[model samples]
Target: FNKYQVTAKPFFATDSCISCGLCEKACPVHNIRVVDKPVWGEFCTSCLACYHVCPQQAVQYGKATRNKHQYFNPHQ
Candidate 1:
């Protein structure tokens, strides 16, 4: 079930991304690196922390999430 519930799919950042380190910092496993953009490592637990923590909402995981709603809960 980990494959469905969690994935290591590479995240794509749009032009709106500010290259901030929030996504990197948000990753509990340290699976993200921000060079000019975010680079995901295989250690991703698919927590989606990088996606929700983004202030620009610029993080996307393939076409499946293109139109999907992004939910961010600080309490998580």
Candidate 2:
């Protein structure tokens, strides 16, 4: 977790989101809805399952994903 996390919310690049529904499926807390726009529910625990599973790399967690090494753990 971030001690100084800037806004705990999933930043979906809607244009990049291919509407694959992986984000919704990967949501551990069932807090995401991929409609015209991704509707993030209040139950989000920030588990980041969807962020990693996203093949399109559309789901981002703040600015941390920018040029950072992605720890791809599909077995998780």
Candidate 3:
């Protein structure tokens, strides 16, 4: 699935977001944009550190993720 790499949908930083910027700071690849609205860029490694560190749990990869232990890469 090299050409079909899993990508995150357009995730919205809801009001629950405290603007802590922790997600932006924690992003290893610096792919998360922390402006008025958080945007995921092409550089995203999908490490999920941002999602895990989010205090409000406002950031999400997509709608399919509802379980607590969802992982982006199965091989990893």
Clash counts for the predictions, in order? 0, 0, 0
Please report the candidate that would top lDDT against the real structure.
1
Candidate 3 colliding pairs: none
Highest TM-score: give the candidate number: 1
Q: How many backbone clashes does candidate 1 have?
A: 0
Alpha-carbon shift of residue 17 in model 3 (angstroms):
1.4
TM-score-wise, the better of 1 and 2 is 1
Worst 10 residues of 2 by lDDT: 1-10
Give me the runs in candidate 2 sitting further than 4 Å from their true place. 1-10, 74-76
lDDT value for model 2: 0.70
Superposing all C-alpha atoms, what RMSD in Å does each candidate have to the true structure?
2.5, 3.1, 5.1
Task: TM-score winner between 1 and 3, please give it.
Answer: 1
lDDT for each residue of candidate 3 in 1-76, tens digit (9 for 90 to 100): 5344645454556677877888898788887888865778777666678887777777776654344653344554
After superposition, which runs of candidate 1 have C-alpha atoms over 4 Å from their true positions? 1-6, 74-76
How high is the CA lDDT of each candidate model?
A: 0.83, 0.70, 0.69
- TM-score: the better of candidates 2 and 3: 2
Summing lDDT over every window of 10 consecutive residues in candidate 1, give the lowest-scoring window. 2-11
